[model samples]
Target: MQTSVIISTYNSPLWLQKVLWGYFAQDRHDFELVIADDGSSDETREMLAAMAPNSPVPIAHVWQPDEGFQKCRILNKAIAVAQGERILLTDGDCVPRRDFVEVHTRLAQPDRFLTGGYFKLPPNVSKALTQDDIAGQQAFNAFWLMRHGLPFTSKLLKVVATSPFDEWLNRLSPARPTWNGHSASCLRSQAIQINGFNEDMQYGGLDVEFGLRLRHVGIEPRHIRYSAIALHLHHGHGYVTQGMKERSHGVKENTRHNRLTWAERGLSQWLDSSNRATLLRDDRLTRF
Candidate 1:
């Protein structure tokens, strides 16, 4: 099946460039890239425009106005315009391994959403990474990370572990598998069935709320955290707050108690032909 990878980003053009380089190095190529831009400055637009011509795959930059932390809304907008049969959701700062797309395609199930995890780098490691490192896949190497100041921890095993062991660990882990925005995949139709992300949510638990709705609609969560990996570039979350977390919790509670399956305001609302045409004509979204 054709796959569309939706990368959410703001103004982190440098990290986004690294992530794109990772995609260019992927073993799998039958996919397109959709950038779900959340109102970045002109710098981001120019960067994307310059990179699109030489990109390994087709790229679409779907941007919305810079309303504060409207990630969910921009994602919905991206989902609205995506042309692939399946959609893989990730952040622009998360660089994928060469086999990332291959693994996601292999594990994709008709009635389930694939949930994966990321190896978060320290700020120093994140800053030290170059496009060459990502293209060469050194950024995902356990030894490379360790030499660059990654602390010694059991989690480090994920970088170099083999199949059965990784599978076993994923099965045995206590952490519940959920739709991690940094790495997750599902059918485009399945995402539409749930009406995409709840636009009311901020950065906190928006992904979790969307996953919960998918479960309510009978889309089971499949754990692939160990199998399909990505490297998360470290960045400060200046927008996240206690109030945001509380609000996210409240949304999660309401969805669980109410068994919400569809978002009230989602992709359907924005997919209107006239609306999409206007968005494209107004310089809000540019396809390349």
Candidate 2:
């Protein structure tokens, strides 16, 4: 089946370039790339425009004004024009492995949704050199394996080797990945039929909520462990200190599409907001 990969990008031009190149290097060439430029201020759009004409696959860009960091809006918008049975979604800052698309295609099934893998740096990454995205990915991968390998393998790895619904999953197979679905790909219709992502989110918590929603909707997840690796360019610390915390404990600074409402409605709306940058400082809007 034809696959359409949806990338929601902001100001990460360099990372986006690598991701596109990786996708181009894929063994399979039957996919299209759809990107939603959530109003980037950098040379990202220009770079994408210049590169699209000569790209190995069909490249399309849907750009909007500098709204807040509304990833859901862009994803929803891109999916409308996308033409593919399977949809792969990844962050612009992460570079997909050459086999990224191939592994998903081979394992794809009708009732099952794929929960690909991702590796993020430890909480201490902020103190270290988090500037290099690729470096960070490597560091995170090693750290990720050390911490959760046993539990992850015993609990969830088998799904990747064989679909649980498929009899083979019960055979002696390793566990699939548990933590990287943001970089994971899914069937286009499965994602949309579940209403895609919660458009109310901008960043951070969106993925977590999405996982919960997918489970509630009875979506069977196929995990990818060994294949579909990617190099994630560093973007510094996250908005929240820990995944559960609402506010960041570190110094507040200007981030790409940085806004005050990040903890509130999410960076999604703020990035697309007209006065998104200025209005975020408004204390009356704090939901947390």
Candidate 3:
């Protein structure tokens, strides 16, 4: 089966390189790397272009001006041009294990979505990190977890079946399939036949909404987070920074609905980059 991996990037140049290189190490025979950059001013474009020529598989770039957090726009477009029947989606900040694709493919079925796992890190570390660094920060992480009071595990992320009516939702229940949006995921045609992601959602709800859409259409997600591990390069805080590293204005709250619109004059600055929903097919490229 042909697989297309879609990685969406903002201004995270250093992290993006590690993520792309991880793709090169995969054992899969057929796949493509689709970089949908959110207008990073760093050496991202140059680095991606340089790597494209020597790549064993195809690499394509889709870029637009910073447009807040419009991941759905890029993802939907990338899926349109993807050569693979199965679409693998992850972030520029995460690096997949060599067996990432293998695990997902093994678990994938026609009517189920696959949500893989990710290992959270601290600020700026790569997959090549030494075990000592991981051990040294164990204490720091423990304090951080207690202080934040956010739900997390040693592996950093966990998945759950969010279906309200499912038997799994009860107090005593057997483990059911799970769904979360951006670690590692594989969805078939049935999952997206209606629409991929609801572009209207701004912050965290979009992925969840899409998962709900899948369930609504009879596509239950297979809870496979811990099984297919990926490394999520760390951030200073638990949250990944969104806007201009200086201004810190892209973050939105329900009261501030204006932050959701990128069309405004000053608001566009908050958005690193964006593009209209479009599909660029291989037919547009000239042959040698």
The C-alpha TM-scores of every prediction are: 0.95, 0.63, 0.66
Clashes of each: 0, 20, 8
Q: What is the C-alpha lDDT of each candidate?
A: 0.87, 0.55, 0.56
Question: Which predicted model would earn the best lDDT?
Answer: 1
Q: Name the weakest run of 10 consecutive residues (lDDT summed) in model 3.
A: 261-270
Q: Give per-residue CA lDDT, model 2, range 76-156, as digits (tens).
A: 666555678788777776666566788778877776666655434233442232334332343234444445332343333
Which ranges of candidate 2 are over 4 A from the true structure? Answer: 119-181, 237-288
User: Which candidate achieves the best TM-score against the true structure?
Assistant: 1
Candidate 1 C-alpha error for residue 52, in Å: 1.8
Q: Which digits, one per residue and each the tens of the lDDT, describe model 3 over residues 69-159? A: 6666666656555557788888887766665677677767877788655656654234344333332333124344444443455334222
Show where candidate 3 strays beyond 4 Å.
Answer: 124-178, 236-288
